[model samples]
Target chain A: MNAIGVDVGGTKIAAAVVSPEGEILNEVRYPTQAIPPNRLVRTIADTITEAKGDFEVGGACVAAPGFVSSAENKVIFAPNLHEIEDIRLDRELGSATGLRITVENDANAAAWGEFRFGAGREFDHQVFITLGTGVGGGVITHGVLLRGAQGAGGELGHVTIDPDGPRCGCGNHGCLEALASGTAIGRRAREVANERPRSALGRLAIDRQVLGEDVTRLASEGDEAALQVLDETGRWLGIGLAGFVNVFNPEVVAVGGGAARAGEFILEPARREVHLRARSPSRDLVRIKEATLGPASGVLGAAALARGEDGEYVLGPSKRVT
Target chain B: MNAIGVDVGGTKIAAAVVSPEGEILNEVRYPTQAIPPNRLVRTIADTITEAKGDFEVGGACVAAPGFVSSAENKVIFAPNLHEIEDIRLDRELGSATGLRITVENDANAAAWGEFRFGAGREFDHQVFITLGTGVGGGVITHGVLLRGAQGAGGELGHVTIDPDGPRCGCGNHGCLEALASGTAIGRRAREVANERPRSALGRLAIDRQVLGEDVTRLASEGDEAALQVLDETGRWLGIGLAGFVNVFNPEVVAVGGGAARAGEFILEPARREVHLRARSPSRDLVRIKEATLGPASGVLGAAALARGEDGEYVLGPSKRVT
Candidate 1:
């Protein structure tokens, strides 16, 4: 079977034709313009049209960066894309593309992709964390995605490591995202560099503003300040993961996103903390690994959603005509 | 239909004949001996026999401690009851009692009891926490119990709150149970008394050993030392609950434990911490309430398990009984 998966990001929209095994056959990308919801729907439809020229689309699924309600096609809330709030993406896209469309939270779609075709392929219960500009997470329990009562479950990044540490974008204090996210890492790196002018990171920051990658690069190069920041962030991430392990007792945890690219520098310490803190039996069974799908996970997972299959993106007959 | 519910605890076994609507028609109790697993099964059968004279018992369910298997009747591991490890509770009890039987973890049963007939009746997604010598928890998502891949998913107490604080029986450090359980609170009170002789708690402890209840009583009386211990424990509990809120995003959190008898003194602080820590959308929807089923929750929950109704302990019917 085949499917079309659309990944809606802040700046661009990418659509791809995916096989049942999650192989991408054809792809199309376009800049996401700051237009009304109706126009945005047309652009997404056009992208799907472009991808359909080479491969038959069975079903279409869209991964939106926000609270996508499963019971309805509406985007309840997308902080980065505020204008799309409550827009019926599924209905609009289905009308434009002339195919059935399903919408899901981007993180959940990515997690579904990983569970079916990436790092979590072998596990029945898994958690996928994407450590990008802000942290996002998806949970699959007993091989079923957990959408909660209001399609608002699996918000792992908001689990607090310190109740009094810092204010978070979600109006919480000391959330894991506020401490360990790529955005958090960069913010801390910049603040520390300014505070400690003699440090190596400070000298590097003289040329450009510090980014999450720069901090990871500096930590790898043996910068004490940078390493300390990464270590602290890893500890907090471990704390959060430990809590998840206790609650879900998942078989595996797949770490994705730009920050996870640091590999052991972040994952090693995080695993150590999880071992030191998580309960036995369940903790012993959990394995931490990097996500395998890379950037394509969202689209593939969304495609699975459209197909209504048990795993990452399901394809249907309607999409085949595309 | 009427069903038999048996709550197997460390000291006593409580059985009840429950109506479909959750009303108890009659009940019986027996002391639980440290006997072999088969004998324990026999004891459960005898209790059911005693209760059968009063009501039309259609099915029987036993709620045991430790990790229940996917089959519900099989006990994967019961560290507290070593002899029961790997025992097929349903088959043994059903054969002996001449009735259909089901088995489940005690916490899951209790949570189900609460969800179907007690405090959580109004919510589709709920979390139940029972605090005693240890912390036990159960999760219900969209009205279904989440018995992860191993049926050992809801180990809420095992989540880490302090990475370096204390060693838990589960071989992890700084677990919520190690820091917030009744045993942990009492232990801390004793340690404080020993270290600070002039403190009020120290004076109270000069006469004899301290109990969790005594510490709670002292804290309620404005004893500063006792208050600190409870406050600290409450904070840790809140931190763990915050993680739960993020993952489950349940509409209700029902707390039932000996420690919860402290009421608002403990619950208010825990709620404050969870509210300050969990993400916005989930935090706004969550309501923390004390468990309302009291001592009967276990047996009632177990009964719900037997009926194979909508609760945590979901069990399959025995072919022989049918």
Candidate 2:
């Protein structure tokens, strides 16, 4: 059997028909910005209906942003996707597509994707962290998603790491998201550029805004200032990872999102920090690596999370890949 | 069938035969300080045997302090109880008592106890934190104990709340334990006393050391310095609890151990801080409360964790309390 996964992201709405083995059979994308304001829900439904064209799909799930209530299958607070918030998604999409449709947090779906087929495929305990515009996280412990009482668990980005270090968009000080997200990386790049005006990163900042991508590019090209910015970001990331390692004791911590493209320049420093802070056995057993599925994780993970009408996983039990 | 639970602590070795309904049928205690060298194992076995007292016990579990490996049923490292470290407990204690005996981390056992019969009895997800000489924690999610890959999971105290605030016993700086434990409370009390020499805490510190208990006592007596110390401790505790609330989304966060005896003085400010720092839905849904079981939580939790020859919980699947 197959399932449809809808990634209702800020920039685009993508729906993919996926097989049990995590193979994508069909996919369609629509630019979210191009959708008329009142047509958001209709466009998403149409995209899913198109993606499911000829496939024998079991169910469908939409991976959206913000505070998602999994039980109610509703997006409570999606800052960018306000058009779809506060409505019972399963009912709306079910009526539209004639399929059992559900909603989930985008990061949680990505994490499930990683757990089902990516870096965490071999481990029962996995923590998936995404460093995009903000830090997002999902946790799988003992093979179950950790959705708290209101399905708002696994918000790893907002934890205080360096208590008084920096201010977070969440109105807290020193959150992991404040110091370690892609946004944080861009912010730190600018600060480093200002401090070392003679460096490549500083010179680039003089021309225009230095994004997280430019930092990775310049560091790969051996720019010392850019390398320092990434190293510092990795250190802060490690501080956050060390806590997760201690708490979840996951076997693999899959780091994804745009900033993770920094790769070893960021992960190596983060690993060093985990070794210094996390306890024995847990610190020794964990493997902190980049997420394998890339941008497609959202759709792939959502498909895996998709359930049949009888309330079972569309992919069934996860099997170990030799 | 009834099961026995042994609590091996720095101060005493106590064992109890507990019924399925969480009733203690028989109990025996031995002062650990009075045990002759190397007789620690013999004394512990004797305590369990004495506590059994002809009860129809199916199995027993020893709730020990240290890094307990649940897989091999071994105590890898016990800082305070070195005599029992690096030994297979199930085999040794099983042979000693002719019953299936297992080993578990003390705090994890306490959390289980709270989950089964105390503050968290009605909740499926609970985070139990003990603030003693140091901080210890255990978590239960979806009615299962969160023992990491090596039974070293649920180490909630080591998370960094204030990255540069203070040094921790684990050699990390600004861990939750470093800022919120009884030792941390005493340290803060001394600092506060020095800063306010006219207060009761300062006057008492001039004659003798002010313990966490003394601060509690003085605060209840309406002393300004003592109240300030507890308020500050609660705030740091809240900082750590806020992260747990976000990450675990537990229905209840139970505060236990000697430091928790301060009650509302330490808990009120912590609640205020949690309200300010934690995100909505999760923060709004969580209840931070004092643990009800007290010292008995150790033994009771161990009893609940006791596994039969079939490797099943002695209490069976949890049932809701009316």
Candidate 3:
């Protein structure tokens, strides 16, 4: 059955009409409105309706950021978006569009998207790590997503890599999030530029704020200071990857998110570290690959969820697709 | 059906006739012979025979340390034992004892035992960490042991906790095993005693070689030096536990193995660190419990494996228990 997959990011909402074969037939994009919760739901409903145009949408899935309640289908806590607490988008949007709806964590949706249609398609067990503004992950074991008891099982970024390193947003010290995220990369670049004014990053900083993109650009352009920053960040990323490799022993690890676009400047060191640290059998078997779906992964995964592609949902109450 | 369970340790071979409800009807133990591969198999087979007694044992499971093959019933690599590479214990023992046999990793067996009959009985998702001579673990996700693609998934102890702390047997530095195992604790005790010659542990070390039991005993008796060692070790254990808690978010974490017998001396600090480090929701829900099954966990887990209690096997070809 054809379904609508909506990706609700902090600034924009992207929706697409997805076919049974994981292909997007049509799409719509709108800047997310941070008005009253009900209005936000209505706007999302309108977007889904527009995206569904000329075809009857059987179901829809909204992938949002933060702590989504498995039991209530509500957004419990969102760190990035404003005033979305306790928003029952699934029920509201379902009633508005006269269709069934499922709301999921954005990262989980993206990982599922990768597992079902991207780099993880051939692997039974896979882990998708996204180094976006923060480090987030999703685990698929034996062809099923592991959602734990609560819906919070795949909080990979919060795992402490260092007990006394930098503080993380999750109120913990030395989390992978604090060391390897795009935000972390930008923060480190700013710090290095401020400390060493003669550095390559400092030269870029004189024109404007040095963002993660600038660091990647400078490193690619043969800037030693930028290369050092990427090398350090990549090492930490590899350490975190090694931990995941040892724990899950997954067949494939798909690395995505905006920062991963830095390419081999970051991933090469990560691959080397994972090779150096992970144990024999898993180290020999596991493959680390770049995620292929790009910005469409979340929408594709949301569509998959709408289609009940995960076989069965283990979290809270779930409605099965006919 | 009655089944025999054999624990193939480096020093000893323990076997038992187990009832369907996990009761040990009869048990036997023998010093493991380390001459030839056939002799070792014969010793294990003989132990199973002695343990079966008058009961008709339908099948048996041998839990040994090292890498068990996914496709073939063989021990691929055993670090603790001498010259057991590529040994097909399952076939030889099956023929010798005239019963079907299954070979599993000792840690996996113990985790199964805990999940089926011990502390993890109520929880569907459980992670068992055995703080033995070397740290090892098992993962039960949705009530099935996560035996990865190649049956090496639950190598939790090899996760890098400290990058520069100590060397692990797995050829990595600062792995959780290097920092929290019974062997690590004993090494710490000896190092402390030798470094601080006038301290309580130093005085004990003067009498003889410091052991993990000696540290526990001294700590229980109010020795400041011994207490400090346990406190530090427990902190590291808690750090590793926090990582597992965040990654898997299992309902219960059962701490087993001989080193965990230190009781409150080690557990209190571990509990405290886990409380301070783990993210909310998971931190509030996860229970860190001392495994009740103790030394018998390995044998009982092997019995569970023989009964095919994991619902389905993700590793290799499995024989269903009828």
Candidate 4:
């Protein structure tokens, strides 16, 4: 049976009707700016209803950004999309689309997407980390999603790598998110750019605000200043990842999201750090690589997570699906 | 049916015949200091044979310290015990004791003990940390022990908390083991003693080396310097635990071993740090408490891990057994 996966993000809403093989049968998208605050829920429901078309969909899952309570099927907090927070998304969407629905953290959905169809398709254990505006993560161990008590497990970005280094949005000091996220990259780029005023990154900073994309682009252009910034970001990312390698012992660490576009620039340093920090066998066995599905992973993963009226995964666990 | 468990440590060889309900039907112990290097394997077999008595034992497991390969059933590296490394303990001991044997990391076995019969008895998700000469840990998520690829997973103590703070035994800087272990407590106690020369801890340091237990004893006696050392130790421990809380999202983090004897002195501050660093719902729900099982956890947990001819837990997973 086909299932619908809706990715409700801060910028846009993406919905796709996906087959059990992870193929996108039909897809639809709407910019978040086009929908009114009160219309958000209805818009999401309409998007899913449209995406399914005549695919004989059994269920759907909405991947939202924030603290999601998977057991309750509700979003506890979504600083970016407050319209869905504290609401019974499953019930609301179920009534609107006539399909059973579940909500999940977008990162978790993306991770599952990679696990099922992309980088982690071959491994039983995986750690998927997305470096976007914020660092978000999801973990799978022993073929099951590691949703901890209350379904809040796998908050990987908030771990402290340097206790006194920097203040984070979560009100903690030196969280991995504060040091490795796109926001962190931009912040570090500015600092490095100022120190090296003759570099491409430094000249770009003088003209306008240097964003994470600018840093990646400048690094790709061989700017020493920007290279140093991304390199440091990779170092910080690896510091956090070394802990994961030691803790989860995953076979693949799929680095995704907007910043992962930096590719080997960030991954190379992270791998080196993991080699230095994580113990043998675990560190030696793990492969830190880029996530393959890109933005569509959200829909692919959410659809895979969708459960039917029979109460089993519509798409099934990938390990057993084949 | 009962199962045999062997705890081969640097100090002693403790073996037990444990019932399916976690009861010790028979037990025996021999000091490692008494055995010659060549006789170590034979002595372990003798201990298992002596401990079983009249019990109908199924399978057995040996909980050893250091890096273990559960799949290979061999100890790769054990700083404290070199005699057993790289040997086929299952084959060697099975031939002698006539029971199928498996090898596991000691900390992992203790964690399973705590999860099955101690503080984490009620929870499916648990993080068990032992604060001894060095910090070691094991995790249970979704009722399965997290042994990473090649079985080196759950090396919790080696996670780097501060990149440049202190060099660890694994050659990393600012590892949780370097900061929060009994060795770390002793090291910090010495440093604090020098800074507060008029305090009780300082006065004691003048007479001899201030050990981790001495700090705990002085703190219990209301010494400010000793209290500061434990409080600081707790703070560092909490920083590391906060990461575990976020990463594992466990219901309870059971703290065991020598330094945990300080109890609330270390726990209270560690809890405070977790509250400050960890996210909501997870931080709110987790209970960080002293592990109830003590030294017996090693033998008890290894016994529980013993597999039958059916390849199932001799005692079964606690959640299923009930």
> Residue B185 in model 1: shift from native, Å?
3.8
Mind giving the per-residue lDDT tens digits that candidate 4 earns over A184-215?
A: 99999989889999999999989999999999
Tens-place lDDT per residue, model 2, B139-210, is 988677888777889999999887677999999998999999999999999999999999999999999988
TM-score of each: 0.87, 0.96, 0.92, 0.96
Per-residue accuracy of model 1 over B178-279 as CA lDDT, tens digit each: 888888989999998888777789898999999999988988888888887888778778887888888787889999989888777678889888877776
Number of the candidate with higher lDDT, 1 or 2: 2
Q: What is the lDDT of residue B287 in candidate 1?
A: 89
User: In candidate 2, which residue pairs clash?
Assistant: none
lDDT of 3 at A71: 49
Off by over 4 Å in 1: A33-38, A53-58, A187-207, A215-232, A307-313, A316-322, B33-38, B53-55, B166-171, B187-210, B215-233, B307-322
Worst 10 residues of 1 chain A by lDDT: A313-322
Against the reference, the lDDT scores of all candidates come to 0.80, 0.91, 0.82, 0.91
DockQ of 3: 0.53
lDDT of 4 by residue, B68-146 (tens): 8877788998876888899998899989999989899898899999988899999999999999998999999877788
What is the overall TM-score of model 4 with all chains considered together?
A: 0.96
Local accuracy of candidate 3 as per-residue lDDT tens digits, B119-206: 8978888999999889999988766677777777799899888878799988888899999999999999998888778878999888
DockQ of 1: 0.44
- Better by lDDT, candidate 4 or 3: 4
Error of 2 at A301 (Å): 1.2
Compared with the true structure, what per-residue lDDT tens digits does model 1 show for residues A208-279? 988999988888899887887788778788888887887887889999999988777788788988887776
